[model samples]
Target: MTKDPKVVSFERTPAYLHHRAMLNRRENNTIDALELMRHAVERSPENREYRLDLAELLYEMGCHEQSNKLLLDLLAEDDGPSECYYGLALNQLGMSDVSGAMKSLKLYQKRDPNGPLLGEVARLAAELTLYESMNRPVSRRLYRATRIADRACEAMREDMPEKACRLFEKTLELASEQYEMRALYAMSLCMVGKVGEAKRNADLAAKGFPPSVRALCVCAQVYGILGEDELAFEMIRRIEDEHPYETERRLFIYTLGEMGLDERAADCARLALQETPYDRELLHVRAIAMKRAGADDRAVAGF
Candidate 1:
């Protein structure tokens, strides 16, 4: 029997697999997406877009070194996209190569002055410049505190709130002015049933000058967990008044969900999705929010 033309075309073309991989990623099926993306890359070895997508997925999965190597290989090609420099900079930052990241950012700006990522590139460049300008002792202390805070964040993600609390305490001792970390510390405290201490830290973080989005979100989460709905809503209002980045917007959505404002969270997620329709993380957040709000149809469609 002869094979069907559609089946032959689907089997032979990498674009179908690539498109499917993107859809799976949007649904937060990262493992399946990774496998599908890998197959697509294998089938179309010379396709730079496929390889770059694979590298970005690897970075999202925390395989920083692998992503960096792939990005480096892409840059070695004379006709590589200027976007590779931005990706390289991200991977370098992930690996703690601040100097290298700065260099890559400069190259990216030089090559693509009108790129879509101009805002992100400028923000990252300013942050890197601030870090580099710090004196050696201050820089070292901040780096140490950041490393401890990273471990604390990992502990929180792993559901070890007590461990995260201890790590955050150590981090605060080294960098006392990091109100964002203090807010996160408050969240860990709340997670472990230390409501009084959590409230204290949250209040202090909320009082910090020029409140940051993450600090506000963490404080809101702590207040919500402590049954202080008024304070929590105020924090959410403050976040809304600010022009937060995508990650911060995600945090705001999560804080709303944590406070049982599922419908509001879904609305915010939908607004964010309108800006970056293909963002897998935002899609995942929106799906969860819609599900919680009893919008089964929309939630199912998202997934």
Candidate 2:
């Protein structure tokens, strides 16, 4: 039989508050969670994980500098966990401080060669290595902006939009007029459930690159998510009129799938399959659509 959860006792221990903070976070009460996290830190000033939890919460709330300070202070202690360096690396990356980010990542790798996060750190380090190709000097601000934007892309693809959006915010501060980056940042905002902000940012992107097929497709997706299906389908019609390439057409199909218009998604999938008959992504999407529509495994497999 399942046992009852432990009851909170009268003694208000730091660990108890920390446990409550985690529970609040799970319930989506971030404000309360943050307050409780702060209380936990105060009560257990010397506890590494308590302080780390507070710093992580601050990071999620976009307080990068403070988060970095806390993480760095933790690292300065003799018994610092190797994970503190990884947290510092994330903060540095969010701030567009690639040098600092790499330094921390390298330190983390050195300290924990076979650590659980080594694979992820190695991937980021490999991407950082690409910056070495700038044989000639590049503009510092622009270079940092691009590096941060690239890191944001990697973060989002890894399903960590909280980190990606924070980095993109820094990227835009440096290169506010980067149209493509703005569009990508809007997508990241969407991933983070900032729908109204996403629409505004996506609109900014569309205004910059009005006639680009890719921009319009993303605009349609944003509109679709904002409950303006008519506008989205209108954008869809515009893309169809433009007769974009097979690869570009995937964007529209993707929006259709996301909008729950599975029939239209399947139709577009079939049309795309006519060109690249064995395209794995399209095939998988087709199979998924079929499965969502109540198809049996055999029928889905046949797709």
Candidate 3:
């Protein structure tokens, strides 16, 4: 008689899929990793670790709204693991909920005062107070638009893209001529997956009152998403040549990184570091670019 071989069933376990997802992430195959993570979550809805992994992946993919929901739900139960607070705080920061982020940071501190991430939370909390506060309404006609736009921005930062988009529409209704507001509304449209409208808004943005650097960055992002590479590159050029402010440069670098333009991102990081060698964020981007370009493991650690 021939010896019988043991049989294995890959479909029987969520862990197998989750492991594959992790491998995909390691290889930078984000689309496959995201889909695999989703399938793993579906198969094991009660697995806290699996949910956390999916949420982390979503956050990395810029789906902060969904990630925040998963993290918040996880934290609602017993909080033995201090990482939940840290993850929640980071998610809140991604969505621009600075107050909420700070609150979560405080919770993280309470849970684990010596947490490695406390430094990042503290830095964000400290910086929240120093933003260039948007000027208040100087005209009665613009007051309602401003209020709605502000609420929309708040919603966007809270990871409520649909709410933000709705609020932005109302803002546009009240002040159709508000170019800056329109640009923001365009971004909201993009968040909600209305790419065509976003592109139209981007086109309209160029004609109206000069847009803020942020608007240009957003427009470029929209163009990139729509596969209009030329327009996207043009927008980036405009940002670099026309708007060379420190804030603008950082935002530009961030946009390039998000676009997955490894060479350009590395170039921007290199140039930016020459000007501000101490900028940790640029250093981080440089490391990411190095890793994406298949540099040795030590390349990232050097940053």
Best by lDDT: 1
RMSD of each: 9.2, 15.7, 12.3
| Best-first order by lDDT | 1, 2, 3
- Model 3 lDDT per residue over 130-172, tens place: 5413444666667988888889999989999899989988888
**Best candidate per TM-score, number?**
1
Give the per-residue lDDT digits (tens) of candidate 2, residues 105-212: 999999999999999999988887677565322778888899898899999899999999999999999989877788788888898899889989987877774566
Query: Worst ten-residue run, lDDT, model 1?
Result: 4-13
Worst 10 residues of 2 by lDDT: 129-138
Candidate structures ordered by TM-score, highest first: 1, 3, 2
> 1 or 3: which has the higher lDDT?
1
The global C-alpha lDDT for each of the candidates, from Candidate 1 onward, is 0.87, 0.81, 0.79
Q: What is the lDDT of residue 51 in candidate 1?
A: 93
Instruction: Give the alpha carbon lDDT tens digit for every residue of 1-303 in model 1.
Output: 987576433364699889989999899998899999999999998999999999999878756667878888888888788888889889788657898999999999998999988889999999999987773345788889988998999999999999999999999999999899999999999999999999999999998879799999999988988999899999999988996766688788888888889888888988987865645566777788778788868445945
Quote the lDDT for 96 in model 3.
Answer: 60
Q: What are the TM-scores, per candidate, against the unseen true structure? A: 0.60, 0.47, 0.52
Lowest lDDT 10-residue stretch of candidate 3: 128-137
Enumerate residue pairs that collide in model 2.
none
